[model samples]
Target: MIIQLLLIPALVLAVVSSLRSRTSLRGQARRKILAVLTVVAGVLAVMFPNTLQALADWTGVTRGTDLLLYALALVIIYLVGSTSVRFREQEARIVLLARQVALADAALRHVEAMQARSQQAADQAPVAAHRGVEGTAAAR
Candidate 1:
């Protein structure tokens, strides 16, 4: 009797989860489904004390305390995993930005070099013209 009752909720949850997974439920609907499942789990767990106690003993941990600890561990691991992924993505972006900056710097330097050469050629033209005029005047 107890075994059948215990399996009933689990079977229903498994079926519902599998069905929902196939059909894409997002936003509010997904949240509502999750909330309902959580409530069902709480109700079923309270209704069946022996199953919870058996699980606690088999795992060699306290009933409620160990469950809480495990839940906390899962939450922490999920948070850290998400944070690490974001950090990696940001790091990649930073590297790309640095490469762009380096390329821009190289281009700017090349432009400045070309400008300097152009200025030097312009500066010599007037002096060369003056020398040519003086030579022509001397010949006269």
Candidate 2:
């Protein structure tokens, strides 16, 4: 029906997007395989709705819809957990990077301040020597 038309494409898109986002080569391969299997299973389920009922009965579930709901719930929980972990890791990396940048800035400022003091001392040296020579001449 109209729902089938809407759901099939949505399901395929979800699988593809999830598969495209991965952290490692091994994970990417695993997800790609899972995505293919999911699409195949989805196609089969759409073609034959009774198979889902049969599967539910075999699994001791009262209804196929209920089984699907349970599976969807599990998937949602897993995605939430993984997303939380990824965010935590990214936050930690950001904090470490900020600390390194702050330290570098402080070091640069300290070096500049030391250089300024040295330059000021050098600038005053000639004036101090000229005054000393003038005082000696006056005394003579």
Candidate 3:
């Protein structure tokens, strides 16, 4: 009873917080709902050991504890797999973002270089014109 009292409100708050978040609402709600349900199920299983035993008996398992352990192991494996997949997806997004940043930087540098070259050419044009006038005067 104490566990449910503590966990239920905490899980509800988590779901509420997720709902308020700016992320994709559907995904966040789905994940939070799954998490709350999993916790509730675990708490129910712990509270009613007899149910676990009955389930084990029906499934040909010798002990409720063994069945519980197997179920936990499978849950752990699934969570790990899902976490790994999310990590890889985030990694790929980071790589793509980095590429975009690099390309932007390169383009900025090219523009700066072109501007500098244009300024240099403009500065030399006046000097070249003055030198040509001086040469013609010397010829006269």
lDDT of each: 0.64, 0.73, 0.74
Clashing pairs in 2: none
Task: For candidate 2, report its TM-score.
Answer: 0.70
Report clash pairs, candidate 3.
Answer: none
lDDT tens string, model 3, 19-116? 34234777667777768988997998989999999877876778889877766655565466556656777888899999999999999999999999
Give TM per candidate. Answer: 0.54, 0.70, 0.71
Ranking by lDDT: 3, 2, 1
Best by TM-score: 3
Model 1 stretches astray by more than 4 angstroms = 1-61
Tens-place lDDT per residue, model 2, 92-123, is: 88999999999999999999999999999999
What's the count of clashing pairs in each model shown?
0, 0, 0
TM-score, candidate number 1: 0.54
- How does candidate 1 score on lDDT? 0.64
Q: Give the distance in Å from residue 14's predicted Cα in candidate 1 to where it truly belongs.
A: 19
The digit string of per-residue lDDT tens for model 1 on 1-140 reads: 44345445655554444333222357348646755766776676678867767765665556755654554454355445545655776788899999999999999999999999999999999999999999999999
User: What is the lDDT, from 0 to 100, of the residue 69 in candidate 2?
Assistant: 73
Q: Candidate 3: worst 10 consecutive residues by lDDT?
A: 14-23
